[model samples]
Target: MTVVDVPGSKSLTARALFLAAAADGVSTLRRPLASEDTEGFAAGLTALGYRVERTPERWSVQGSPAGPPHDTAEVYCRDGATTARFLPTLTAAGHGTYRFDASAQMRRRPVAPLTRALRALGVDVRHEESEGHHPLTVTADGVRGGELALDAGESSQYLTALLLLGPLTRDGLRITVTRLVSAPYVGITIAMMRAFGVTVSRENTSRGEVFSVPPGGYRAADYAIEPDASTASYFFAAAALTGHETTVPGLGRGALQGDLRFVDVLERMGARVRVDDDRTTVSGTGTLRGITVGMRDVSDTMPTLAAIAPYASGPVRIEDVGNTRVKECDRLAACAENLRALGVSVTTGEDWIEVSPGTPRPARIATRADHRIAMSFAVASLRTPGITFDDPGCVRKTFPAFHEVFARTRAAWGLAAAASPDR
Candidate 1:
């Protein structure tokens, strides 16, 4: 068996930074992910006059319950949607003029719903250029939260931003979500908020599901982040495709991230999956079975499944991932294009993709500068040699050492299989 240690969760790391900043006292984050997106979030905190200390394995932040110390600040969010959306919302509870911008690609993504919701709460939000895009400013005088409605069909980051802002408000916030995608991500936010000393309430109303966040702010503590489950999908899928057993620790039955459920998809593909309290293992059964799955909540792993679909016995159909259209790139289109380059038959709808079984040919995959694109296709390279990435270093957005770690893990799997080929 090949045991792998993945980095801490990016979703958790970003939320931890925000919670640590909003808490009543000092907060320490252990095992937080060190990547371009997360590091940029920390940098945004620092620009807002929050004291954030970083180390090799741990990060500490001094909270300011009153909001940002600086009255005026300019923050540049690299490629992280969390930083672009959440940071500005975090600033809305303070007294300041905070201007937030992002990368060219991030600016193209949607931020209107979050900003509109912020405006309805009596905050002043000004768009620098596009009405619903980034390069925006938030003029804050504190928030008196109240009943509001939002649409989260395009992205869940908008809802997460407001949920994080609830405790910082005067009366708290009660949000009615009309259309939601990636519901599990909101669960992660509420869970992390509870960790920082706040509990958000949820209920199904006639209008929609209402989330009630109470005021009193967050309390600081030493928080430990879990391993990123989305990043683990590639390794688990690689094992399933190559008929090797691989184990990733820190993502177990109690793991908070929703992407860990990708193991269930592997099990459907004829892999033996063992889920324990502290770890989960995936061992290939020497066969790959194609499956049709709805990925509304676990859409991040869609590409991972798509990359390995060609090896399955039947057609693999992934549905309910329309939000993927506005992600780092058009993921459905990217998957279909890459699969075709490998000589596999594939079809894509607005929100669904069906990949047929075939012998994948070696080809250069265009990553579109998206990290998931590169990591997913890397698993296909395990069986189909000569597969290369157009942009290999794009994995830095999440896992900086992905190539190094994956290479070592791949080598260990080879040795393990050679030692016991019959197993």
Candidate 2:
């Protein structure tokens, strides 16, 4: 079997970019992902008056914590919601007016929570289009941080934005989040903030609680990004569904990604899981049992697990994942609809999804333009006889080399390209 190394974590990349842009001195990031999302973040930093130099393996960003360009400039974030959400807060820390816009897909993504939080922090933010959405004009006078509550159930990007900007506020920020979903991603944010010399504390006593960010700027340090565990989930699922052993290197025992728990889910489904200091190995036991679990924290892996659920002997039910509705697509509906299209019995809800294992049916899977959907379904194709993805290129947003990785790994299972009709 041909082994492949996944790219750097997108979550880490975005946080690193923000930290590098806000730090006092020149900061270098090693093995930074150069996908569309990350490039958009770099571009946003440039528009905000930070000097960014990019190479194949590293990025050097010169910080301008002072603020955006001399003249008010417009920043286009394309389809990267991380850039659209976080850059506005950074821009608000500086002088001058900044207009932020994004692609239609990103524009449809909710920004109200973050905008409202920024307004509450004393920044002048106006929604140029629909209320609580993008096309924003932000004029930064200053910030007066205090107690604020944000509903970030839709997207964790809002909480991440507030956390990144909190240290810059005068009184340090006390953010209270209600109905907080995607808690794992918030963990990534907090860890990255700590690495950059910012302190944040979270209370677990109640669903609605406060987070405190100490008033200070980020410290420059040499940081290496861990391999993406979300991308590794597809490969682990491929191994589980196809009865092949797949070992993804670079994600060690104490990796930062919450999606790393997906390997444990696969193990519960009758796969063998091995974790080492620098790699994780998943080997199928040739049979999978159905599992019912609450995936609120690890919701990003729902599509990967759902894709492989058809290979199990019973039904797999995933719950506590209502936040998937606001992702690039309605992931619950996409999983149910695509699994049904493949002739599998499926049921879906506003927050949860269920899939019953059944005989494989050859079909063209629609990814709904979501990267995770494309990667997860492509992994599913390894076992399902004639599955093909309608738009396989959708994986470029995260793992640009996903198809190549699959081709290299397919040989271990005696698989070959099946004359893709969709291509």
Model 1 score (lDDT): 0.92
Model 1 over residues 215-251: C-alpha lDDT tens digits?
9999998999999999999999999999999999988
Which window of ten consecutive residues has the lowest lDDT sum in model 1?
414-423
Whole-model lDDT per candidate: 0.92, 0.84
Count backbone overlaps in model 2.
0
Number of the top TM-score candidate: 1
- All-Cα superposition RMSD per candidate: 3.5, 1.6
Per-residue lDDT for 263 in model 1?
Answer: 95
Candidate 2, TM-score vs. the true structure?
Answer: 0.96
Angstrom error of the Cα, residue 51, model 1: value is 0.5
Show model 2 residue runs off by greater than 4 Å: 69-71, 204-207, 420-422
Error of 1 at 297 (Å): 0.5
